[model samples]
Target chain A: NAGVTQTPKFRILKIGQSMTLQCTQDMNHNYMYWYRQDPGMGLKLIYYSVGAGITDKGEVPNGYNVSRSTTEDFPLRLELAAPSQTSVYFCASSTGVGETQYFGPGTRLLVL
Target chain B: AQSVTQPDIHITVSEGASLELRCNYSYGATPYLFWYVQSPGQGLQLLLKYFSGDTLVQGIKGFEAEFKRSQSSFNLRKPSVHWSDAAEYFCAVGAWSPDKVIFGPGTSLSVIP
Candidate 1:
């Protein structure tokens, strides 16, 4: 299985710009999550979905949005990028919450 | 509230030496603990996990962890360290069914030859 995959491995965005980070998982996991990791800091949850058509806010949800249109896809949208949004974004999915979350290669975004 | 802590920000060990990375967590009940390794510029990879039963769980890459409920700790240990083992290690804890995990700040492991 391919596990989890994320697109746009690296990107640069100006303040107020917008973009979407694509995430897809070959495993039919019901739960998907988005997290951002800052330098010398732990990963912070941005958003998550238990299944298709279900989404919820997480620890750091500001300046971000997420949609779970299908069991395999959960994309994170940066709708007004800010300097704070510049960090490594990771997409993970699991069979259920608090299970072993398989992570994709992170996306590094720089907001200037 | 659930949280994880890797008290040591960085650890250095000579090749072939034993290594231990500390991890402590805060939660109300029995927690699902995990250890993950992240290579530079990559995503987090699961090293091992603890749900119940065996407190000491063996993971990939000769990594093992001991979960101590009294101390609220789940420390990762490797008997012999290799240069390739240099990476950031993260500790996380939470349980299933209306629970979410929180990760530690991460401990960067450096192996000297």
Candidate 2:
């Protein structure tokens, strides 16, 4: 099974351009999260979903938005890309709270 | 707010030498601790985790960690280092409900032959 899959492994966007980073998991996990990793920094949570139709902002969710319409999908949207938004983004899922998370390869974004 | 810290930004070791990566955390009550490794160009993978019971926890790839509550530390250790073990290691702290995790800046390991 494809544990967690993210689309567009690499992307380049212009300032003010919008795009969505897609994430899917076949494991049927109830908890999903989006995180970004900058150079020399630990992963920072952008958003998280408890279940379908339930979402919440995380530590760093300023320039992003997320929606969970189905259990297998949680997509993060960047409304207006900026240089600061350029980073490696990861998607993770787990069966429940306190469970070990499975991470996707990661999407590297560059805003020009 | 809960947080994790990896003191070493990078560590280099001769192959077959002992290795340790330090991790310190700040949290109230009991903490669930975890270690994850990321190979270059690869996603992160779980190494081990500590919730309760024994303070010493064994993990994959001949790695282990000791959770010291009094010191608020969970440091990863290996008896002998392998070249294949070179990767970035991260320490994380979390709980059961709410399931929010805080990750520390990773420690990159390099093994020289």
Candidate 3:
């Protein structure tokens, strides 16, 4: 069912460049989340959505934005890419809060 | 705020040997704990979770974890290690929401034949 899917598995961006990371889930989950994982560190939440048209900031939401236009899609936007933003970004979804979240393959971003 | 700690950064065990990975968490109220495994170049997969009741929870790939409330620890164990079990294991604590979950730094497991 393609539990969760992300686009451009690997990407490179220059300083100040902007991009959008696309994520889609077929699980019909009501919750979606964005997280960034740095080397030697655990994942940090960037943003999340409770349902379509409802989004909220997470632990590390700075320099990032998200939108949940449909139940199946949640996209993360980077307004101005910076070196610190270079990390692997993962998208996940769950049926509800506290449910087992299914993750996508992840998008590796490198800012030069 | 909830947090998790994985004491071991890396561990090595011979094939068919017993194995254990330690995890500790801090939270104000009853904790919802989980263990996930990640293989190289792959996404994280749920191994097991603990909500309430049973202190011992079974997971996939012949793995199990014991939750000790007194010590605030949830340790993963395997009776017999396999080469395929070599991966990074993460312990996390959270409430009912996924965004509230906090992950540990992760422990790397290596199996030698």
TM-score of chain A of 1: 0.98
Residue-wise C-alpha lDDT for candidate 1, range A1-112, written one tens digit per residue? 8899999999999999999999999899999999999988899989999999999998889888889989999999999999988899999998986678999999999999
Q: Give the C-alpha miss distance for residue A96 in model 2, angstroms.
A: 1.0
lDDT of 2 by residue, B1-113 (tens): 67788989999999999999999999876779999999998789999998899999999999999999889999999999999999999999987664468899999999999
List residue ranges in candidate 2 displaced over 4 A.
none
* TM-score order of candidates, top first: 3, 2, 1
Model 2 chain A poorest 10 in a row by lDDT: A94-103
Error of 3 at B18 (Å): 1.0
Cα-based TM-score, every candidate: 0.97, 0.97, 0.98
Q: Judge the docking of candidate 1 as incorrect, acceptable, medium or high.
A: medium
**Model 3: DockQ vs. true structure:** 0.76
Error of 2 at A109 (Å): 0.3
Ranking by lDDT: 2, 3, 1
Each prediction's DockQ against the real complex? 0.73, 0.71, 0.76
Model 1 residue A79 CA deviation in Å: 0.8
Off by over 4 Å in 1: B97-99
Instruction: Go through the candidates in order and give the C-alpha RMSD of each one to the true structure.
Output: 1.1, 1.0, 0.9
Off by over 4 Å in 3: none
Give the per-residue lDDT of model 1 (tens digit) for B1-113.
56788999999999999999999888989888899999988899999998899899999999999999999999999999999999999998876652368889999999999
